[model samples]
Target chain A: MVRYKAIIAYDGTNFNGFQRQSTGRTVQEEVEKTITKMANQRVEIHGSGRTDAGVHALGQVIHFDFPYERPLEKMRFGLDTQTPDDVAVKSVEIVADDFHSRYLVKEKIYEFRVDIGKPRSPFRRFYASYFPYAVDVAKIERALPDFLGTHDFTSFCATGSSVEDKTRTIYEANVTVNEAGDELVFTFRGDGFLYKMIRIMVGTLLKIGNDRMPADSIPAIIAGKDRNLAGPTAHPEGLYLKEVRY
Target chain B: MVRYKAIIAYDGTNFNGFQRQSTGRTVQEEVEKTITKMANQRVEIHGSGRTDAGVHALGQVIHFDFPYERPLEKMRFGLDTQTPDDVAVKSVEIVADDFHSRYLVKEKIYEFRVDIGKPRSPFRRFYASYFPYAVDVAKIERALPDFLGTHDFTSFCATGSSVEDKTRTIYEANVTVNEAGDELVFTFRGDGFLYKMIRIMVGTLLKIGNDRMPADSIPAIIAGKDRNLAGPTAHPEGLYLKEVRY
Candidate 1:
């Protein structure tokens, strides 16, 4: 068998999530179904990680083993044509047998988009989180650097996350505004992230930007290791898995 | 009674069309329902024009009568809150008793978006038409001026349009690329448009851009007055009713 690695992009609006379940449509189920049909056999695929419902992805990675060899371009074309419109197989390549989509990940980059425009745009309702209230972008920018380096992110993680070790290394963190100056994009590059950690961080940063919370509270929040010390989790719609680096 | 004129925007992915009908959900139905609920009485609204299914709107004008006068801001807020998430009430104002949304329209601007990026973006699938083949934007730009000025646009009109007068004034026609250079937006401003006229014109222009048709064939097509001579109508998803002016 030959192992293949592929990068995929998906609009998660209509999906339950990236993981497969008995009910509800999912990205994994759709991709597997398409690939299995194309291969004329049952095939399972492995993903780098799971993204929650309503969260989009631009470079989600996955790997699968095929029974026989085929041209990479032909395989890519076949997968692209067979997959659902909401899911796109961007590129495919042969990979080493030892390559693991999940365990071998080195870094990850995520993006969260916020629409700061008034009278929220209908076209962006599904793709961006609307924040009509006043926000200080400069203050948010000043606070972004605090998220870099290693920290025990228990306060930022979702309450139900069962992982014991909450420490993760954030290599880079920054915020940028689009050319129109109506939207804010927060980008985070990290060794790993806890459940809903990025969303909670964004939520806290937005609160700081709005002056509801102190701008310099990240250190205390991380040291406290209590979820209640952090702000509420942001909406899922604005979050995107931008890249999974190996 | 007080007359109110409102500018509305909607994501038409889930809507049947702009006009109210007995069957599927429509923009008019949603807006009327929200107003009727707030007024505690049935309210009928007149729109500037109708847009087909899957066609979005950024500045659709509508006028309706209410039993009493309320603060314009309050009415706008109520409509914004009560309407579905995919619909937004941009602004509301009190208009003259004789003012009519449809009859007083002096101009209209429509936009058609084309996705020229390879491997179509999943996020833009519902908003832009994907053309993976080669297209020359310069050719499209060169062909745009031919659509300007007054002309009998019979060839650009759809086959089923019953309007006898096929003449219309085109004040401006241009094609612009976005900052990302992955999208081509075709903007057309005219006195009025017939059914599917903008879409047909965009379809023809895209054909010219792709070298499938002669770049200077627009004049002959307009003089022909035959729908068969024009290119196929573009997809409805890429078309937007950008503005209705008075």
Candidate 2:
């Protein structure tokens, strides 16, 4: 048996998410179905993690075992042909037999974009969130540093999370503006995340940026360990899983 | 009465292009309906041009005459609130009554994105075209200069074009890549274009980039005044009308 690790990218707009489901379309189901047709055997794709519907991903990692040894290029093209236009296998490489995408990943990066202008950009609607209210960039920037490093992110996670451990190590968290364009991108890289953690963090940050919360209150929110203490979670459309590093 | 010209943006994935159609959902129809509701008056929007179904736009220009003389911000926000999330009114401002989005525009810019990789990116599935084969960047670059300046772009347009003037001035035409990402964006700013002109140009350029067409043939394709001279028109998903300059 040969183990192959594939770098995946997908527009989750039309999908139910990454995992296989009994009904509705899914990224994993599509990939596995395509691979099954090509390999003449049922193949299961293990993804690094799951993203909600309407979210997106680039460099999302997945691993699967194929009985026959195929060239990386061939596997890539074969998978590409079988997948829908919105989901792509960006790269495929041979890996050690025991390699697993979720267990081996070192960090994951996600970007959430906000269009902070009065004029809504229709073209960017699917890729970014639009917030017409005034935002205090300085306040959000000041509060972002508090989210960096290991912390109990219970307040930032969605309620009913199955995660037993809330102490995730956030390698970095920051906000940057695309000066050429009037847009802001929030980037987060972390060892692991709870369900809807990034979206909620963005919501909390937006509240802080808009002066709804004090910049220095981030630690308190984390310490409270209460999801209700955080602001409402942002919409799913603007979030994108940019990459996963191993 | 006030004449307003707005820069618009929209995700065309769910639209049947920019024009108002009776049977299908259209960007123009959506915006027009929104304006009619806001102004309590029938409004007709004159767009710079119509885009095919599934073609996106970042800076599409449209002009409409409104009987109510409201603040630009109010009008912009009103229209934004009324329109669906897929289409957005980016900016609104007063313009000369003589100004027409189609006639008075100085230039229009459009971009086509191609993903040259083994696995297709799912996140950008609605925004880019996939090409699994390796591209010859040098050959594609060499052919760019020939497309600049004034030329009869008949061959690069669809056969059903009804426009009397096939001649258009291309101010800038080039293929540049994102420095950090595995994506290629082809931008073209021109005085005007025939129907399917940009898509045909992209198709031909893609062929040249893939070594299907010789670099020297671009000029001949333009001069031939025959649509058959160019390659197949590219998919609409990868195209975007980025901006229209007054």
Candidate 3:
């Protein structure tokens, strides 16, 4: 048996996210089917993490074991030949048998794009969240320092999550406005995230950015330990899993 | 009646084309409906040019006459309120009665993007054309200078065109590759174009760029006045009307 690691990039617009499901198409199923066809055997893939539907990825990491022995170049070529156009294996390499994508991951980064324009462009509808309202950039910038450290993040997590621990360390959190002054990008890097935590943090920050909430209220929201204390969850379309660090 | 000129933009993925058709929705009908609803009277819109199905526009020029009078700001707001999210009237201004979008246009610019990769990206599938082979950019650049002046370009035009004059001045033609080396953008600015002219030009350029045709053969192809001399028309999804100048 040979263990292989691959870096993937995909547009999750039509996918049911990364996990396999019987009812719909998924990124994992698509790659697995292609691999099975090439290897003439069933293959199970282990991904670094799961992404919600309509969320895109640039450098998602995954590992799989193939029955046939092959060089990294052959494996890369075979996967490219079998995989569909939407998903591409950017790179492949041989890894130790003990290597695991999930357990070995050190950190992950996600970016959310918001199109804050009165008239949204059709070209951007699938890639950005359109909010036709005013937002104060200074206010949003002032609130970023509050989310940099370790926190329970219970209030920011979605309700009914199965995860037991909500505490996560955020390495960085920043909000930037594009030069066009019509778009904003919110980026976060962290060790781990609870269900829908990033989206909720974005919403809460948007409210504060628009002056609907005070920057000082971030601590109170985090301390509330209730999902209702945070703002609404942003759309999945605007979120992208940008990178996974080892 | 007051004449109003407006700048429009749309993602053409959802519409049949710029012109109205009985089989499916068109951008023209959508804009006309919105104008009628806002003015409380039917209005006729004349676009500077027509784009085929699956093509997009960033700054398309259009003209319409309305009996009702309103401030430019108010009319723009009202039309935006009633128009679909995909199609937007970016700006509206009262123009001289004789200002015709099509006849008064001095130049039009179109952009075509091609992605050169084995595995296509799903997010960019709707926005770019994918070519799996490597292209010789030097050959394409060498062939482009031959097409920069006024000439009979019937050979570069697709068949079934209704226009009688095949002569038009090409103000500029440039091909710049993205830094990633996986994408190329072809930009053309000209007095006007015959039906599918830009598409055919792109196809022929790709042939030269890919070394399928010799760079020196471009002038001969244009002078031949035969569609067979040119390459196949490219896909419409990769084409965009970048702007219209009047």
Candidate 4:
């Protein structure tokens, strides 16, 4: 048996998320469908993580095992022909048998896009989150560093998550604002993230940046370890799994 | 009755065209449907020109008459709230009775996007034309000047167009290549354009740039004034009605 690892990019607007479910479409389902058509047999793919519904991805990683081998280029093109235009297998390479996509410990970088000040664009509606209110970049920048280092992110995690251990390490966090363009891109690089952790963190940052929450609310929220202590979760459409580094 | 002019933007992926049609959904149909709901009576809009199926627009101009006065912003928001996310009323203003959208003499700017030497993007498939070939930007730039000045563009116009006079003044033409990004954006500004003129021009220019046709072939093709003399018409998804200069 041969294992193949692939980097995938998806729009995620029409998808129910990256995981397979009983109903609705998912990115993993589309990939499996394409690979099955190529291999002429049922196949399953393992994704590194699960993004929520309406979330996009630039470099989500996945691995699958095939009974026989095929040229990577042929496999790539074959997958492209079968899947819809919104999903693409960006790159593929053969990997060791032990290289499991999810079990391999690695850092994941995520980007969240926000369109601010300017009117929302019809073309960008499916990709960017539109916020017409004012955003104070200085406040957001100041609060970003609070997310660095290891912490039990219980307050940032969504309620009802099956995840029991909430401790995770955030290697870096950044907030960049294109003032002229009225856009904001927040990036988070961590060893791992809990369910809806990044979205909750962004929402809390925005609340503080907009002066709805106290300037020093982040440390308190993290220490509180209560879901209700954090601000509302940001929309999923703006979140993207940007990269996975092993 | 009061006259209002609107600058609109649409993705055009789901639309049949900018004009009302009997079968498929159209940008005009959506706009009129929303306004009809607002005004409580039948109303029609006059657009600057018709965009073919699968064509997008950034600043398409349209004018219509209403039975009563309304704030421009309110009307814009109301139309947005009623229509699908793909179409947006970018701006609105009350215009004089003499202001006719289609009859006003002005220049129009059109843009064509080409994804050169890169894999097709999942998110941009509905907007950009993917040409997986190396492009010679210098060759395209050299051939562009030959297209400037007043000329009969019958060779560039799509066949079966009803317009008899194909003579149009080319105000400016520019070619820009994003070297790092492997993308090309071609802009054409003229008093007006023939049916698919910009697209045909782009295709012919690409032909020359890719060494399929001679660099000096443009002048001869324009002089020929026959539809058979020009290169193939480019796809509609890459064409955008960028702006209208009043």
- Using Cα atoms, each model's DockQ against the true complex is 0.75, 0.68, 0.56, 0.62
lDDT of 1 by residue, B103-206 (tens): 99999999999998757888889899888888999888888999899989989998888899989999999999988788999999999998999999999998
Sorted by TM-score (best first), the order is: 1, 4, 3, 2
Error of 3 at A200 (Å): 1.3
Residue-level lDDT of model 2, residues A45-137, one tens digit each, is 899999888888877899999998998888888787778878877789999998999998889999999988657666566678877788888
Q: Model 3, B123-241: lDDT tens per residue?
A: 67888877777699999899888999999989977788888999999999999998877788999999998889888888888888888889998889988999999998988888899
Per-residue lDDT tens digits for candidate 2, residues B36-139, read 87778899999998999999988889999998688888888778778898877778999888988998878889999987654556656678877767788888
Which has the greatest TM-score? Answer: 1
| lDDT per residue as tens, model 4, A1-246 | 899998888999999999998999999999898888777899899999898789999889999998898898887776766788888777889999999889995899999988773347777788778776777888888888888999999999999999999999999999887656667899999999999999999888888888888767788899999999999898998899999988
TM-score of 1: 0.97
Q: Tell me the alpha-carbon RMSD of every candidate.
A: 1.5, 2.7, 2.3, 2.0
Q: Which residue pairs clash within candidate 1?
A: none
TM-score of the first chain alone, every candidate: 0.99, 0.97, 0.96, 0.97
Candidate 4 overall lDDT versus native: 0.88
Ranking by DockQ: 1, 2, 4, 3
lDDT of 3 by residue, A1-246 (tens): 899899888888889999998777899999999888877889989999999888888788999998867977778877866777668777898889999999998999999999897667778787887777789988888888888899999998989999998999999999888887878999999998888999999988888887889977888888888999988899988898888988
DockQ result, candidate 1 = 0.75
As for TM-score, the candidate ahead, 2 or 4, is 4
